[model samples]
Target: MDIPQVISKQAAETGEMGQEYLATGKQVSMRRWEQAASEFGETHCREYETVGMLISGILELDLDGQTATLGAGDSWLVPEGAPHRYRIVEAVVAIEATSPPARFNNRDEPTSGEA
Candidate 1:
């Protein structure tokens, strides 16, 4: 996929799920999730690894049938190809990074950084 070249933080690409801030290098993709507690997500088995930090709210991750609940200041690592699914237990704000970029990411063009 053609990851658009970016310089600094700008308006990121988002979908029905959440917003993502993509890097120009195409080596990483980051996103923030702020969903209502009523929201539920399907199972996911990603091709890339992920490292994430829980900034606020609540989240429940089901990794191959093992469930774990996370809150503010908590962090986690999801290995590539791990089957996992999660739900927003409370309105959440989490920051996550994906290696080799995420296939779900979308971008129109790069703009000036948010810095």
Candidate 2:
């Protein structure tokens, strides 16, 4: 499958937004997001590796029991099966890439509650 690039200028200006960029086989998926004062629910990738780069603003990442704040030019790697969560404390954009593309069982649902 051919994956397209995702841009987030609109999300950046508006505060909070997310987009999926590319997916190759089941090997990887790339995503982008612009967040403003939002918290991402805790989750885990059962069989994938995740890596992310903070393009702008600040991100509070909680991996397992360890917590860290990442800002512009910062990056992180989350090994497979790690329970993690993140929060956006400021208007920010980030590029995230995952190997063995994270399978979101509820991607099409309005919310996890609806699934």
Candidate with top lDDT is 1
Model 2 stretches with alpha carbons more than 4 Å out: 1-17, 23-26, 43-46, 103-115
Worst window of 10 by summed lDDT in candidate 2 = 106-115
What are the Cα lDDT values of the candidates? 0.70, 0.67
Clash count list over all predictions: 3, 1
Q: How accurate is candidate 2 locally (lDDT)?
A: 0.67
Report the lDDT tens digits of candidate 1 across residue range 1-115: 7656653445666654455555535577776666678544566677678889999998988887888999999998888778777778988888888886764443212212211
> What's the distance in Å from true for residue 81, model 1?
0.7
Per-residue CA lDDT of model 2 for 8-110, tens digit only, reads 6443322113454544345676777766777766454445687889999998888887889999999999887677778788878888787766435433223
